[model samples]
Target: MTLDFSWAGEKGCVSLFPNPEFHLENVPAGAKSVSLTLTQGVREMGGEELPLPRNGILPAGTFRTFAPCNPGVYQWTAQAKSATGEVLSEARKARYYPSDEVAEHKP
Candidate 1:
């Protein structure tokens, strides 16, 4: 499968903030869900693992994959994992898209 990261930065450069916009293609059979994560070096930013639709076909084109809503230099990973958490296949992309929104306060 192919993964596309949506963040605003020059190609192969570090990007600040989070952009949930992502795209996936050619997901393999027997895959249970797609997990997306953002990281700055060894630190976790945020992530999500979403189950595929009942038809087994994902949404067309681009969609928000996960909400890594923190500001930092982060790289992204998209993986197709089994129900038992075995990674089937994965893709990684660095630095794509931009956003101005931050996570809301919960006080």
Candidate 2:
């Protein structure tokens, strides 16, 4: 699975404000639910779990929004679990900068 960040740049840089919507891709079949977790350093920022559709499939364009409290590198984890106890997970890292920091680096 892959994590899509709505506010991320090409190099995995994110902005501090407006937060970001996280999207999943390549979710496996038979997934009953999915969960998203965000962390910075050793602190967990936020997390949520969403049940899949009645067909046991994730809907197209389904997404979760997470708020970052500070500017730094964040780790994201997405996990999908099936009724049979099968789990699929993916992780990614992104650097977040303050709005002013982003503006200063803009080309």
Candidate 3:
């Protein structure tokens, strides 16, 4: 698996085309300084964990990945930088395009 993405941690948000599928094994093995965070907002939105990008990375925070949401506009942010906060000081946005899920009728 090849990691195909421009490491834009110094200018803009990591925006993805309304997608909902990814893999971690595809990320670059040489990845060293990258921070990935996934978040969403909903009416009475709560802690949630939606599908993340393929080989996405995150940091330690009070944020929860257990938020349940419907088909709508969601938001995400990723901060990639150095320890000294030099050279690199930027983030990216994830545009999640949720697909249709078929649920079987329960008797």
Candidate 4:
């Protein structure tokens, strides 16, 4: 299983908002649903978590686009699970920086 995604037009100089899009590819046959999480740093920023997909669960094989997030380095995760909440497969990516100089970013 594979998950592809991108954060659309996120720039602090222009805007602090992010519009993220997702594309699911080769989902496992045993998977019943998928959940996507985008975390800003280790803790919720500005008193809130990044907005998640409605209900937090998407049907398998869903190709969704257009979600909002804050501009910063983040930890992104996508999980595939069975009906009983058992994880079938999981994908993780780290060291995501919205800015080119994210290492020195303050927000």
lDDT of candidates 1 onward, in order = 0.57, 0.53, 0.33, 0.47
Which residue pairs overlap in candidate 1's backbone? 6-96, 7-96, 7-97, 8-96, 8-97
Expressed as tens digits, the lDDT of each residue in 1-107 for candidate 3 is: 22112212212223322222222333333333444344444332223233233346333232433322444334443333344433233333333324323222111
Clashes of each: 5, 0, 18, 0
- Model 3 residue 84 lDDT? 45
Q: Measured by TM-score, how close is model 3 to the native structure?
A: 0.33
Off by over 4 Å in 2: 8-19, 53-67, 98-107
Compared with the true structure, what per-residue lDDT tens digits does model 4 show for residues 1-107? 55554443443333333324455566666666666664565553221122224333333223322222444566446677777767777665433445423232223
Enumerate residue pairs that collide in model 4: none
Which RMSD does model 4 reach against the true structure? 8.0
Give the least accurate 10-residue stretch of model 3, judged by summed lDDT.
3-12
Where is model 1 more than 4 Å wrong at Cα?
A: 8-19, 53-72, 96-107
Per-model TM against the reference:
0.57, 0.58, 0.33, 0.52
Best-fitting candidate, measured by lDDT?
1
Error of 1 at 42 (Å): 1.8
